[model samples]
Target: MLLPKQMTRVLIVGSRNALKDTIEVLYQLEAAHLIDFSAEEEGFSLGAPLPESSVASQRLLKLRSLEKDMGIDDEDVSGQMETGQIEMDLASTIDGLEAEITGAIESKNKINLRINELEADKAVLQSFQALPLDLELYHDYDSLKVFTGKVRGDPSALVKAAAPQSEVFLSGNGDFAAVFVNTAQADEAQKALVQVGYTEVPAPAGPGSPQKHVAKIDEELEALRSSMKEAVDKLDELKDKHSTFVKAADEHLSIIVEKAETPLRIGTTEYTFAMDAWVPTSEMPKVEKAIAEKLGNRAHLESLEVMSRMEPHGHDEEGEEHAPAKVEEIPVKLENGKTAKKFEFMSGMLSTPKYREIDPTSAMMITLPIFFGLMVGDIGYGIPFMLLGLIGLKKCVSDEWKTISTLLFFGGIWATVFGVFLFGEAYGIHFAEQAHDLSWSSLLGVQLPHELVLGGFEIPLGIYSKLHSVKQILYMSVWIGIAHLFIGFCIGFYNKSIRYGMKHAIIEKISWLMILVGGALLLLFVVDFMILGKDVALTDIRMLVAAVLLVIGIGMAYKGEGSGAILELPGLMGNIISYTRLAAIGMSKAGLALAFNTIAFEVMWGHDFHVLGSNSGDIVMLIAALGIFLVGHLTIFILAIISAGLHSLRLHYVEFFMKFYEGGGVEFKPLKVIRKYTIEKNGVSE
Candidate 1:
């Protein structure tokens, strides 16, 4: 399974008419997964010069073609229902319906036509409503003919009058008028006007009247209103019918398009069809079974065969011979219930070292939990993390996210283990009560105390003894740093040995291992010699030899071409020492919690306010103490998590990865309809 990894290149082919369909399907597939693929423009030749166009346009064209093939019409029920049915169809017959429906819906002219018709009818109705009524047509002579009633004033005097003859005309604005026969009749008109609340006008003597044309125009306007209403109703009915037919047509069109375009092929190999795609690698029997059940074997068949390698070429005598490009191939191996290649992530990154190189989904899985656990490193926090990760793993729709969830599941376990260690309860050893008592002996032989000498007298002080000992905390910080560095070395060795061969692995990968071990021994031996005033005993020869071996190994495995310089060695040593920050921050979080609790109880309670002394002050003091404890601890907890998480990532990225990781491996993305934040049964699309 050891071979040089090669970049993947895909070739897609179809009819000229199907090009747009192919682009659309490819786009959908790309959106659905995290896999990276790009089409090669040099593979095809343009017959004529044309402006570049949007893929959406091509998709639209393909959809139109499919609709035409299916005989879809907006006003035709048969076609509209056919398209709608095809869209809703769960069977294999409806495969590629989305593209078809999208195209058909876009290409439809009926909806636009209906909209225009409605707009025209509305305009006509509005125009009729806005027409101004004729005024000043009610002269004395014209009024006398229209009304058979007496005027409200004397025959010689002008007075307002009302027209009571027609429902189509209004009496206001002098559009119509009433006529009186004599002065005696005028008084009677006045009585009638008072009852109706109107003032009459005097009649004029004239045969020619302008109100005649006004009446005629009113009659025509009434007819126009009736016609406009009928037209509006018909337009609404047409729109409803058009919408129904368009929907039906879209369904039928989807089916026709799917049948027209065959599954993509590379030479003699046919790509497995699923959700507008031809998937590669069908080793999973379940996938094949699914394909068979959905699409009959005759239409969608699966065949297994190894792809052929490109041939090499020889050059002519005149110049150097041209050689066929050799395609580097990676041998896949099965591990952890999945197929994987060594250095896959690294190789992929190198191949496409751009924005697309990084997989955010995978990064989330690997980084988030590591960050969370480092922040809340307690059994209590781990439980919640484990549960959350499990839920994400089970329900995540993106395959990439599912992979991340899996990482969180494992990280939670490690965090839980580390928390147990911090609790001082390893192997049933409990230090709950004695945690603050520095006089307590070491658990598992790890020193817990520091010493102080005053006035020529020696005094022993423990790191965990005081409620808040900055010096003690610093000592614990150093120890944590030491442990973190050691862990990094181990990870480095493991990663390199697996990824690269032992030849390269030993010199580059094992450098950290030697540095950590050798440095620890040297520090411990020097400390022992200085503190106890003892010479290096013969009995400790083995440790001395081990230290010597580590130093020699580090020198041999040195990676840089720089000459061995004393200055460089110190820098390298410092880098190794930097790993201790992981443990330092973790311990700092715990230490801060203890310090806050102590301050809250001592400072807050020590204050005696006689004015507020009825034990009420004590209760308030207690509440304040608890508040300070929570707030202080919570702040420290957050800082510690940030420190641990960042340092851990730094150790992995810079220190550990420096030894071996060359992450650039392309991720495997399959063609499928994936729901975001939800689950689906049998891989159905929404």
Candidate 2:
């Protein structure tokens, strides 16, 4: 389809008591894209969550916390248990599981805390152990001043000279020192200690010898570590036992909570609730039938309006007049077949197509990969790309990977086709033979034909070489760009005509179309007269027509868009020139291939200046040539994906799409459930 699917506004009203049943039917139908409730509705309020939600929610929260504490993951679990089994076990098991998990975690925390304390105490004791003193002697000294810390050098002689009545102790390592001096001479002792570059560490308060204290703390740490290990093992056991059940029960309870809370988005009164939504026009009949059969008199559905592509009309009226209709943002639901759906995300990256306009995914899918192929143009790389894409499609699940795979698969097909017919090349070499260059015919030691005679006509395999046909390829790309933009402007004209009016559409888009056509004609004339070196007169028919068209087109554009149109004239010229990159990239890759081939075969072999020249006869030289050939080609292959892939995408996003696309419409998001770990069983479809 050219545009998104049409939508119809629906109002579903039901008694407050029947809200639950009505919600169940809607989920089962899976058609509505519900609008949120607003306070503007008189006598209506937002509905509260059901009573069952509270208990289930609380239990689910605790279960998640337990899952985290035990390091339980969905991947770690292996089997699915029955829903009945889960429901039966959840109530009784949750409370006991919570108690067990909480106790295990608390014990682990306590052990960790004690281990940290013991480790700190052991560190302090180790420093004191060097002094050969009891911990009590370092702290309990009223008539003495004790200086205990690590020192740069032993200061026994210095301390003795400063305080005559001082006692000094030195560690066997001589890094720890303790000086005790009479209270009257403490100031002198401190000054003497400062000369030895001492930094004080306060003596730890304890009653035992330092060596015994260290031993005691080490014993306690070992016991705490053992307890910590036991706690970890217990947590692991619980995870192994319950990860599957926990994930499944979480899915089950989550579905219940979500359905119960549906009324939160619907307006509610004391007696009834109102639900506003959009459903595809085609599905409206099915929805209506389901509601009538399931809900009966408990609910009422009113089809308010069937939306159209044309914008709504409103204007000022007399005395008893109505307010102008506001332009509602219709959500876009693209209609695409399986093949086209793969390209949807690429277009969606810019924004969803507006409901009233064309869905551009089809156009993008056709052109994007072709541009990629044109830039690459080689069967050697194309086959690998196709293989990569096929593998990715099979193994990868994400939308991004799948889209990339789609590009590679489609692009590879076009690349191979162009390589065989248009360029007759693989890995930048012509399939047959070319003057002063290598070819597969020479490499394989066989003759290859340049053309095949079919039904009395000669068909050339190689039409135009990428590096040798720069001007022709560049000219063709420019014309291709012009044709693509012409299509863009036409689509834009149609969109604008429906959205506003024909007059506005013609002035905005048709005017630009006229300018583009005139410029294209002028380019043809210029190429013929200048590049072809053909004589041409100023009064030539093509020149006269181009001048007139350009003047009229610019006049119309300036009238519609003011002076901004004039400023954009140069930009239009630049957009056309941008297409030259298609040929430029191909030429660059060909040049690289030629250089690698020369280095590996011609220069190294030094026998003939040809790409297919035999490698050096020496065994070591042959191996070196083969290594260079592999590594050099490998670099080009990897680079081809990046440069070719990104540049082709850029041409679409920046140049082609800018011609008409003004995306940013809201995407249609229907109320639905996506199941992962749990599946409905026993013929239940919910």
- The most accurate candidate by TM-score is 2
Residue lDDT tens for model 1, 1-686: 12222223233334443343443454344421212222232343222111222332344455455445444454444321322343344233223454444444443434445545555544333322222332243333433333222222332222343323322223333323344334434455444445544543333333333254434445555665565555555444443434343343333333334323322322121222222222334343443454345433333333323332221243232222255384322222212113222123322432421111122223323443454454345554455456656897779866555544554455566556544544432111223334433212332235443344679875533223222433443445445455545554454444444433354345654655566666666666765677557787745764686578677766655442224423445765666556445445555565665566457646454533111222343567778877886677567644544565456555555653443334344333433333221222223343
Candidate 2 per-residue lDDT over residues 468-582, each given as its tens digit: 8888988988987888778888888887777666877788889999999999989989998999988998888888889988999999988887788899899989988988888
The lDDT values for all models are 0.42, 0.84
Model 1 lowest lDDT segment of ten = 352-361
| True-structure Cα RMSD, model 2 | 3.7
Could you tell me every candidate's TM-score relative to the true structure? 0.45, 0.92
